[model samples]
Target: MLEIVAVPAFADNYLWLIHDPVSGETVAVDPGDSVPLLAEAERRGWPIGQVWNTHWHPDHSGGNEAVKQAGATVYAPASEAARIPGVDVALKEGDRVRIGEHQAEVWEVPGHTLGHIAYVLRDDGIAFVGDTLFAMGCGRLFEGTPQQMFESLQRIAALPADTRLYCAHEYTLSNARFAAAAEPANDAIAHRLKAVEQARQAGEMTVPTTVAEELQTNVFVRAHDPQDFARLRTSKDTFR
Candidate 1:
């Protein structure tokens, strides 16, 4: 089993650290900064050997060069190779990534960025969804269309409900608030918002939310169709 650790970085971002104790192999997901990640790894005595990139965002790939310099093999999205630096392997949809005895499937989920992708480790019932799918919201239509993002979200939601989603940002509290406003009739969203607020007040992280939880509370994923999804995206873009 891979032990997943949340390494907080650059404001609200999360750089996940995946460790397999049996083999003593460690991997980093979206490590935006090298200082904290390397320090934390040394502090915990877990030497990271691989770096995985979900997209080309600087905040997600800024540390790729440094991490690779430390002997870590860099794996990044094939389509975004030109944007991401120091990639040793270029991955695409349906690709398989292995760490120790654990393996994960690669999913090409564009919309937030033209070449965004996510890693689904079904064996561990976990997914490292960068900015594509948040706890109670989806990514903005930065480089792709609403239909593209909607389709990506639909594909993610179709995964096992028990799958625990690991998003890269700590924006669940604000997203939950939007969910409540977007769907006033959804009691589930209201309840979730209450809990999220409490957690934030107590300085607790609200990420690693389950697919089932998002299905019930995320307004974007709950969108009935592509057009509905587009409306929600626009409203969320300007939601205050």
Candidate 2:
């Protein structure tokens, strides 16, 4: 089994460190800041051998150079290579990356960014989704259209029900609030909202959410069509 640790950075971002005991190989995913990420890896005695980025956003790829300098090979989206620093390997859709004995298939899940991608470890039933999909929400579509985002989210939703989606932010509380409003009649949303509220109050992480959970409570995923998704995405922009 892989040991995944969440290293929090920049108030809400989570930089993931994945360690495979069998191969003794470690990988850093979307490391925005190398300081904490490196420290945590050292503490665990897991030297980072690879850095995998999902996009070119500063907050997601800021530490690319630093991690690369520390002897880690950097892997970033081929389409956004110009924006990402120190990329040793440029990955595209259908590409495969390996850490120890585990393999991840690169999926083009553009939405949050025009070049955003996801790393899906199908055998492990895990996906590192970057900013494309959130706990009960979706990315803001900064460089992609609502139609693109809708399709990306639907693709993620089509994964196995038990697949664990590892999104990059800690936005579950606010998303849950909006989900409750988006589906006032949904008992699942109400129930999940209450749970998320309590989790946040207790300072607990509410991510690595399952596909099944999102299907039951995420309004964006439940949207009837691209038009409905667009409206929901527009509404969420200024939901407060």
**Residue 162, candidate 2: alpha-carbon lDDT:** 100
lDDT of 2 at 12: 98
For model 2, how does the per-residue alpha-carbon lDDT over 7-80 read when each residue is reduced to its tens digit?
Answer: 99998999999999999999999999999999999999999999999999988999988888888999999999
lDDT, each prediction: 0.93, 0.94
lDDT of 1 by residue, 162-193 (tens): 99999999999889988989999999999999
Cα lDDT of candidate 2 equals 0.94
Question: Runs in model 1 with CA error above 4 Å?
Answer: none
Query: Against the correct fold, how does model 2 do in TM-score?
Result: 0.99
Please identify model 2 stretches exceeding 4 Å from their true place: none
